[model samples]
Target: MEASPSTQSPATKARLRTKTGCSTCRQRRIKCGEEKPACRNCISASRGCVWPGPEELDRRLRKFREQLYPKTTAATKATVIVNNVTPLSPTLLPTDIFSLAELDLIHHWLNVLSDLLVLPNADPACVAGHSFETLRMMTGCSGLKSAILACSASNKSTLSKDPRYQVASLRYYDEAIRYVSDAVADIGHGSKAPSDMLITAMTYLWGPDGELDARKHVAAAITLMKIRYQTAPKQICDSLAASWWYRVVYESVLYQAFFLAIRKPLSPDFDVDPELFQLQGESQHLEPFATVLERQPLILGLPLSLYYLMIAVIKTPQLPEAQRQAQLLELRAELALWETLTDDDKPDADVHSKFQANAVALFVLATSLLLDQMCEQCLLAGSPAELTTTSHTRWQVFAALRLLHRPDVSEMWKRCYLGAWPILVVGYSAHEEEHISSIRSMLRQMVERTGYGEFQRILEELEGLWASKR
Candidate 1:
């Protein structure tokens, strides 16, 4: 859900040859380059020559808006601000900046990380589109801000191969933990306090450079949420409903499921779809494969459903064998349905839609993994070559990866950000040397393109797995 591309005004579109613009002009992001004390542009513009402070950013943005959108009324501009400026804690990902490297990390978080967190067609209001837009709306919350900084710095270290950045990340992480812990301990009847505590705990998992106990943090948040829901003031509840608090919960659950390889409890009351989609329109350009499992209502409604079901089974290992068997049979039947579904699935025509269709196939494959666990049967699962072309988990993953070769999907394919998880399992099942080589090559490319450390680790694990068998 990256922010819609800003329409570059004709005046601000070009890099005015102001390689030496004054502090004031630079701050305003306007064009100007002249002698100190009073540049001609400044004099003509009737502005001070001194360095404009951060406080003046709003004024400059307004001036630019007036110039560019002259026809827009004040009320219309306010509407724009409301829609565009859902600030998430002053856009601070580093907490505090020191060197240019840290600054670059912040930039990356704003641009790339935000994109990775959301889909291209996601609702901007729901997802943290661009960091600035989110930062604009975020009110003060030190612990949450610190956790975000830690995550950013962690990513920066991974991307830049700079160990020094980890230092700041660790500091911020520790600060967030301390603040959040204290707040939780002293939750003495304040309505907003519990929400703040929960937000801090949820955000900690997203931070970098630590063996964070995510389950503990989540438990704290859950406990606080129960208390807050019952006792919090109406205003606070409304704010939490509209704010990213639910997003925090979603992320925490995802982290627990992904990293721990287990499911957390899903409250019947919890639902995030309304936040994700407002207009219940069709799949847009992605309609060709609309009936595929990826496009299926269930998977689309909750992409994380497979993960949730897996976690539930794992968490409730105490379930009776009869109940377990019944559940497994039900899930397996669901998987079988997806296995035969291919009517509009292959969209080689539109590469963008093809990428999405393949994504759905990946989800179907994920379903297979759980089915194998439940039925204790291979059920179309085997070595890469042995896999059924249309259905098997290994085959689907291979097929999905193959789609990346298309020029349209190649650019995104190179970015291992989205498909890492599926690849990990796909690589694990690669028995043949050629299949193993292909998976390895794909992961290496993903690592090179995204600087996502996990891709490299997955590649190494797969290599080790293959080696051990040999």
Candidate 2:
């Protein structure tokens, strides 16, 4: 019962006028006197005279030329043959021809990136090749063509500083930010439940600029965790909710710890004191591993394991000497917990291994930041005895950096040390631009190879630090 294309109503054709008229007169739904160039209506209306109506414009000129010289029979036949070729079908249009499978592949790639952000210890390399493959396929999609153009126009490192690219990048980054914000708003009103993947997506999307708004996302995540924790049956707690709750707690605490480490204050509206502090404390006492051992296979345990460790580092700067000493004792306890998880008897060996690696990297970074802060404290308090401890802390951080062979981690350490180096060296009368230049050159090379754009921001931060010192 499909309608035939040939049976469809024919389009109305516009009629040709023999008279010339003003452009305005032709468009006004009025009749024009059949006159030559510069019609009577145009002259009365004070409009510029225009020649020929839409349909008659070309035909009249052709007729006038035909009067001067007629076309041969062969030329007329060639024109007839040219008009016989039909236009391309709608289904075969450039934009309509993409395979559904290609669209699904692009969706999968986007989801993988989302997975990396929320899940702690996710391997970015797992989707490395897939990203390029998706980009290749996406080139065919006309909808994505505009995105490709925008991405290409704004992708240069140097041009990132230009105002035009800055505006475009902000637009793209804002769209992503708005997406997370909308999800958080949904969870806040209890209108929608928060998923683990959603939390991961928020965390993954957060860049340096995201530090300010992260508390909102973290709060929503915590609310979801509390709801899940309370509503799940006891049997489900052992079988399902435990690992899920742990991830929620871990990521929530990790983001909070990151905020604290960066010296950003928590929002006044966030008042879930117990949930915040509870995750900050040792996970062993907070949640029993024995209860969740069977379900560990289904959860990522690394974020939970590293949460306590990172919190210890975040607490270092604010803690008094006695409190820090006590916390170090607790840190040793948490480190022991980490060691125990790596034991052969652990139920989820793969998760434990990844968690161990991430924990080691975070612990090292936290330790470095702690040592840097401690060094600053000692200098301020004029404590000469603490210098030895400071040196030992630096050595520990250096050794830890060696253990973590990741380029991103290594670059972070380099910047941290670079910030502290001037203080250490200049204090001891060893300041030199050559030394600074050499480090800068090395960092530039690292940035070129890795394409981690945040380091450029770090470099600017370092410049400010050096300027402040001088």
Candidate 3:
């Protein structure tokens, strides 16, 4: 063995496993160099080089802190005050302003606000002080914070069944609405406020008085958005702020308003131009809500807005099939856009995914509308067999019915039912048994979840259609 050592070949080296790419790159199925500081691939692509693991970031932060202050005391750490009695001004900004960290803080507060609005037994007063502090820290404009605080306070009191609490809640809602209105007015006067401020204001206004003055507020909000679209920079106008997301929120407000407006008079004073209200391509003359989705594809508001827009249109008599088809095509485009954005391996992938799900739900709604249109056309043309030809018409309708009952489809059902019910009636009358049975099952599920009035109306409509057939 000693003699043969020089002649013996070197032992083969073990194969080394290379580290995989960052999470974002892996998700996108892209190659990554996985370099330090910033990944080479991300830098080359001009994208953010976010690491794969939060643990790595946490470790780095801990190490940095240790290096900065080896003997730092507990008292030196910043403490966020959950409760403070100081009244926030309507137009003041915190000293440390303008950073991603600040934006995250604002988002956190908004989440808390959302939770307070929806969560049963959530204490509004306990949250009020924190809300005020959060508003103060996040917004430079004191008026905006005050309005947010007012809404936060109102959300707390509104949960109570007692008349006193109800009154208090209304008062808070009114105060918040007024402050937000003032802020909006201030923006019109050349104040450099973010467009989101207006959205937040509208949210609070509708949140409280949705059952009262939603239509009027919705109209006002749309007018404001249109004005901004016209005058704001082209970049801002072309961006998400000007797009369907804003319109979607407006549509939601309008839907609530429509429900309330049913009790109000439909005189010349409240009349809007029918053509202008149609959901079609963007135009200056169109209702702001209708154009929002067309302008912004990535915004979650597009689907919601489309859902409500369809509801509004369906309630009206004599909607042209051509127009409906055009709108459905536009919604399909929006869904495609949402898929593209969500599929990107970006930091906001989770949010984009949520938005994609919402878009799918909206697509389901659009399919339902298309189905309704097809059924209506069949009835009008006296071609009963055309309704169940197993072609695009029948399949689309069936697919929509299937999606309507899906767990992920709940958010848009209220709007879906508005469109679906009419189609169901027409289908039942035409003796399309398969479609009728499917729609009936979906409606039954809806009855358990929707309000009493809506459920009763749908049931009555179904019964009346059946009686007419008999």
Candidate 4:
């Protein structure tokens, strides 16, 4: 073996390589004088002087396709996909690349959105009263930061409605994908469990537009959790287990409901017979992480339980008539039981408590939304097989809508960044014209007051649904 010639000396390496120039100027054998970022020569020639990163950075020459997909968007950058490699995936960015505005956005996500989501959004560090820099200093992970920046941009886009925020949102979203892919890739090559920050950030990305991204991160988080289920150090395992079920999974469930609202109908075809599947319950065993459910709060657990139960009820197209009716009765009884229990939880001043109370109520309303329809199909279905003409249907849907607007609800929206989907879903399913009018009025008010693109989008979707119904 040509005994691998000894490694080249640093002096020799330095002498052999030119110090600095834009990749384009270097390729063209021209003097670059490396004008800081872009080369003067490249600037004069109207070509991009892609600077390689500080590490090795022979630098890049931006091609036409770069604008097609940017790593991050400026307030003024054109919005489009960066043809980085794939549309769904982009290359990771260096951690230190954030500008002041980008940094501010990231902090906003940390202090506000992350704090609100502490219960269900998986932000393990309930970072209140802390600066972004402080948190960054305490725990540093590029993948987690990238994910946070992505969510911040996405949330900002909802509030700003500016094309720039949309551009930024897309940019950060791709950056998050790239970062996570690299982190997971490292794990595949022989790393231990992924950073808890990545799991925390994954839960924050739960929203209408980012559900698939959220799920992608979740799948990876679950894998790591399973791999370390038995063998990891207790400290590491505890970090992963801290509210892992309550924050990570429950938050995803909430977003899943939001995303499904306009994208597809929640229930399978009403006419099809639902198969036998375990209904969601507070008591079910989740492999490797049973403690999540075992210890989850009823405030959160109640809605989650309803979500599963409701999902089952809507799919009851082929059920044995007797069993279907019995299940419906059982669910009704459960809803009533929860309502009675939650009365004790409904405090007057604590916004967090109020929000949770309202959330539980919304779950019941959402379940009722489907149950009403399911019950109306025929004599075999139940007594009231028609939801369209029922005054009770109007009242139930409207009641849910009102709970969402209670004084504390707006506070919940400000902090948690909850979407308007569930509120609108109840309205969308409302058959009463008066109830429908109130829903429209409520949505319009929310959009005009908040300028949140989500509300505006909800308004547009509602209109579309109404148009189709008409």
The 0-to-1 C-alpha lDDT of every candidate, in the order given, reads 0.50, 0.40, 0.43, 0.50
* Candidate 2 lDDT for residue 358: 41
The lDDT, on a scale of 0 to 1, for candidate 2 is 0.40
Off by over 4 Å in 2: 1-169, 172-192, 195-201, 225-307, 317-362, 365-393, 397-453, 466-470
lDDT (Cα, 0-100) at 26 in candidate 1: 77
The estimated TM-scores of all candidates read 0.59, 0.44, 0.41, 0.59
Clashes in each model (backbone N, CA, C under 3 Å)?
12, 1, 15, 11
Per-residue lDDT of candidate 1, residues 1-470 (tens digit): 42333865666554323224456777777776543335677888898865333343333334553575568555434422322322221112322432334344444555455544444333443444224433432335656656666777776565555576688788878877887777877776454546543454454444463234654655555455445534644544344345443443434433433444431121121222221211235523212211122232211223455545544433332346456556666666766776554234564456556666655566456545534543443343333222232223445545645654556666665653556666765665567777777778878766654556667767886788789768
> Mind giving the per-residue lDDT tens digits that candidate 3 earns over 195-285?
6556546644654444456567666655565555455635443543434333333344444334343222111123333443445566444
For candidate 3, the lDDT comes to 0.43
Which portions of model 4 miss their true places by more than 4 Å? 1-98, 115-134, 137-139, 189-191, 204-265, 268-304, 317-326, 339-351, 378-393, 405-421, 432-434, 444-457
Better of 1 and 2 by lDDT: 1
